[model samples]
Target: MTEHPHVNIKRYRLIRTIVIVWMSVIVFAAFLLNIPRINILEHTARNLYFHVPMWFTMMGAVGVSAWHSVQVLRGGSIISDIRAAQAARVGAWFGVLGLATGIVWARFTWYVGSDIWWNFDPRQTMAALQLLIYGAYFVLRSALDDPEKRARLSAAYNLLAFSTVPFLLYVLPRQMASLHPGADGNPAFSEMTDPVMKLVFYPAVIGFIGLFWLLYTQRVRMSWLAYRIQGESKY
Candidate 1:
């Protein structure tokens, strides 16, 4: 079956506008809602709405890359390769945002009076290492001259590297003695019963996820367009 050409600019614009408005409203609500105090737990909780979304989005990007990797390995499709590369680019952006937001949260909640920048915390170290691994994937892609080889090798690397994300985001943090609270430990809100906080927090997550999808679609479309342009020049 032939694919339908259904690139509706109006629909894309409407969806984009809705996502932007939703994000703006969520941010405004987050700022206006008055919490009792700026204690360590409370301050850290604020970062949940921002930092956690970054990490989640990053994972989503990596997942896309992995799916494309599988497609390329199985079918040798250039579209899959293009998608994998685009996803890595987006994932890198989200990873950087996650790290920056984490740093800010760490400064306010963990390093209350200190100026030390690099702590040996497992969460910090593992997250940084994850970023470095993904960065290397880009470097490897640029270093290769053959498109087929680059695609295959990068796909392999993506699969291998993505395996670390779950460990870094979940396992490592839970295993080590860190300033950040573990999933099952104290300060963990596994059983949050507050209706007001839930109302705000759940929407914030959904809004941020929608924003991530909007950006990902735009980036992938641009990448596909660039690929088509390049291909046409040689035809």
Candidate 2:
């Protein structure tokens, strides 16, 4: 196997350090920063820094996966295949975190007095369905034995799954009556957001996306190393 030219170890380490510090500051400010609080979204409003960014990071990861999947389909390179799979895996975890955070956030804010942890809110439901689609991509990979064939087939399935992300997370949810912000003609978080919150929100999004890239790159490196150690050059 050829040395990976694209991954710069020194640069990656530097950026990883930066991301660690950046996210630490973002988290500290998210909880400690004073901002105007709305009626229902009092203290829980701090979740905006964490929850919303998780989805943004997930979407960014999915985009990276789709891009590498295209590379796999175009050139059938094993390295690209490895990247696509790792990107999707990391991205899917972010999606799961986003859903979990949303659930906890809603439990306190929306369904505070009720025993409902989940009420099938349209946005939440669609997000869950979207994750299941990605889940199938992994299962499909496991079912196939040939590396090249698995890469090809799973890349195709991954593209199909990526196609539904926008609709499931954005379009369809906005069309339905939902408790989530930016649904059913409701104002988006951006529209009515305080400028103070945006200070932390934007950086949080960038930090989480950087985190996804870090994790995805690490997995790809490990996978490539494993293949090399096993005497499999074609991967």
Tell me each candidate's TM-score: 0.86, 0.95
lDDT of 2 at 220: 86
Candidate 2 residue pairs in backbone clash: none
lDDT of 1 by residue, 1-235 (tens): 3331333566667888988998898888777776555455574566667777787788888998899998898976777887788887887788899888888778867886797666867788888999999999999888887778888998999999888889987787877777766633535445542455665677777777677667766776776677667762210
lDDT of each: 0.76, 0.89
| TM-score between model 2 and native | 0.95
Off by over 4 Å in 1: 1-11, 36-38, 41-44, 183-186, 191-195, 232-235
Clashing pairs in 1: none
Candidate 1 to native Cα RMSD, angstroms: 3.5
* Alpha carbon lDDT at 57, candidate 1: 81
lDDT string, candidate 2, 78-195, tens digits: 7898899899999999999999999999998889889799999999999999999999999998888888788889999999999999899989999999988899978888887899
